[model samples]
Target: MSPSHHGTEPVFDVTGVTKVYTSGEVEVRALAGIDLQLFAGEIAVLLGPSGSGKSTLLNIIGGLDRATSGSVLFNGRDLTDFSDRQLTRFRRDHIGFVFQFYNLIPSLTAWENVSLVTEVARDPMTPDEALAMVNLTDRMSHFPAQLSGGEQQRVAIARAIAKRPEVLLCDEPTGALDSKTGVIVLEALTRINTEFGTTTAIITHNAGIQQIAHRVFQFLDGRIASMHVNEARIAATEVEW
Candidate 1:
């Protein structure tokens, strides 16, 4: 779906956020003073190279990691002040994550793997329902090894979204796949964002993928270097480098 203009508060409102990792004689800053917002029903793409901190910012926003300083507000609540337990609960209740690698359990079938998370979610859709979103209903009974790379990634996407989370954070969701397979994965993601209205943030090295986002943020040296709205957005099926 196109970005909504119903005038809701931002899902994520971050300001001057920072993250630093100390290693003896050296200190590495993963994020340096970032200010950004992910509005409801918006698709944002984080475009940058290996050390640009795009993933670091995504992790913080998704509650997978904490910022070293500044504010991280989720719908007006200060996430920076949340306790570890609170952060855990927040992630469980509000966020879904998809990574580049298909982290599906080798022993479990697609349905079983997705079921594992839905069972614990507060208001989850059925495993079959989730699988259908990623167009994997026909292959739900297949084990991870039985599927193609794209199919496995689709299963992973199903597992992430089955919980009906308000936001979906994806870190290089197509990174490990070839362009043809990557297009299918991106299509799945675009479908999820449209059908569920899940505020989405994707981190990718492929600048071509920016065409699918409502807004594109370019990161460099641990900071956002540039950002722009894509007025002429295109479908993922039409994306090409």
Candidate 2:
């Protein structure tokens, strides 16, 4: 499905963004210079190998990390200029992040894990509603240890969506799961995007997953090598590793 370019303004406008990590005398450039636009309500798949700077760019846009140079504008506001407190609020109020590992508190039930976000969000769905989004309402009371890996990931997704974020940033969300289980997680992600019209960006090593996105970006050596619109997007179930 093609994403709706509802407005001329992009959700995220990244320009000349670069990231450099320093350790002692060594300075490693993670991002050379990135110029990208993430439109509102679009599913963008970033494909690259390890150390390709896809994750670094994702982190910068998500407000998890700062760029060494250049500007990152979110809805016309310059994120790179924001104070630490403002960045924290920006992440909490607008961005939902899902990492490769399901970072659930083992002691917390699925419902509780999701509730943790709803409790702090400005306008959040109920934990029940979030669990229902992932088709995990029946397992809401189960602990993470009792659930399978896919189930745990779904719960983590539920927690992220509970806050009704405007943007969902996922870094290798399905990397830890098998092909069968990964598709299940992808289904949940696509469903959420369709339902909420959330601007979603996913970084994945699985090139096949790009077929499910509205647009695909190929990263190489800390820069975007190529980008294209997927005119004939497929469903999550149709994606293969």
What are the per-model numbers of colliding residue pairs? 1, 0
Q: Estimate each model's TM-score.
A: 0.97, 0.98
Q: Could you give candidate 2's per-residue lDDT for residues 105-178 as a string of tens digits?
A: 99999999999999999999999999999999999999999999999999999999999999999999999999
lDDT of 1 by residue, 1-241 (tens): 3576577788899999999999998999999899998999889999999999999999999998999998999989999899999999999999999998888999999999999999999999999999999898899999999999999999999999999999999999989998999999999999988888889999999999999999999999999999998898999999996
Model 2 C-alpha lDDT versus the unseen true structure: 0.95
lDDT (CA) for every model shown? 0.93, 0.95
Which pairs clash in model 2? none
The CA-based lDDT of model 1 is what? Answer: 0.93
Candidate 1 regions with alpha-carbon error over 4 angstroms = 1-6
Query: What lDDT does candidate 1 reach at residue 181?
Result: 91
List candidate 2 segments past 4 Å from native: none
Best by lDDT: 2
